[model samples]
Target: MPCRPSFSSGFDGTSDQDAAMEAADPRGSESDGTWEELRLLKPREVRHLIWEQVPLVDASSSQEYLRHHLPGALHLPHGARLQQLRNVLPDLSQPLILYSNAQNRAAALARRLSNLDYANVYVLGGGIGILLALQDA
Candidate 1:
C-alpha cells in the first residue's frame, strides 16, 4: 500500500498544530519563511512612536513638506544636499522613520540612508494620509 499525505500536513511536512504554534509564537520565520513577530502597525502606533521622540524624516519636497507635515519632522527632500542630512542628523544610530506622499520617494530616501549606514531606518507604510487619518480619529 502507498503512504498518503495527512490533512494536517503543511508544505514542509509539519503538522497543522506545529504551524499554528509557530504562528502564535513571536520570534522569526517559521518553515514558510514568514516573520512570526512582524506586523504592519496602524497610524496611531506611528503617531505614538513619533510622540515618544522617535526621529521622523519627511522625504517629500520642500514645498510639500512646508505645506503640511508632522510638527517636528525633519525635512530631507531627496536629492538635496546630503551634507544637510549629516548636519541635521548627527546620530546615525537613531530610529529614523522616512515617509512621503508615495512609496517611491520614501523607499529611495530609505535606500540612501541605508547606504549611509543608518542602522535603525524604517519607511512608514501608507504615508502621510494614514497619519492624517489617525490625527483625525
Candidate 2:
C-alpha cells in the first residue's frame, strides 16, 4: 500500500529526553501497572523476525488499520474487549506483536494481553507509522 501523505502519526512534539524517558518507563503516561513484562520492538527488528512467524496484531482504529498495516496483521483495535481478543487468539502462550497509530495505545493493549495470560506479548515501539516509514525507506 502507498503511504498516506496526510496520515495522522499521532506524535506530539515531545523532546528526545521525554521519548527516552517513556521508553525507559513503558508505563509512561498510560501507566496501568500491566506492561512491565511487555517487550518493545523496532520496525527493523520486527522485519528480521518475520521468519519466525510471529503474529502481528493491529490495534489501531479500524479505518487507519485498513488503510495501511504490516502484511498478515490481524485487527484487534484497542477498544475491543479482552474476550474478543481471546477469541481471535486462542493460544495464550503464542508469541505475538501488536501495533497501533502510536506506542501508548499498543502498549496499553499489550499490557492487557499480558494480564490476560498471553505469556509472550510485544508491541511495536513506534507503532505502524514507524513500520510504514521503514518500508518506504
Which of the numbered candidates is closest to the native, going by highest lDDT? 2
Winning candidate number (TM-score): 2
Q: Candidate 2 on 1-137: residue-level lDDT in tens?
A: 42222322443434343354346555555566455566887655565455467777888888887787777777888678788768877999988888888777788788788777899888877666665654344
TM-score (C-alpha) between model 2 and the true structure: 0.71
Find the number of clashing residue pairs for candidate 2.
0
Q: Assess every candidate by TM-score.
A: 0.66, 0.71
Q: What is the lDDT of residue 135 in candidate 1?
A: 37
Summarize candidate 1's per-residue lDDT along 76-118 as a digit string, tens digits. Answer: 8978776788798878888877778753477677777777887
Q: Count the backbone clashes (under 3 Å) in each candidate.
A: 0, 0
CA lDDT of every candidate: 0.61, 0.69
- Residue 127, candidate 2: Cα error in Å is 1.2
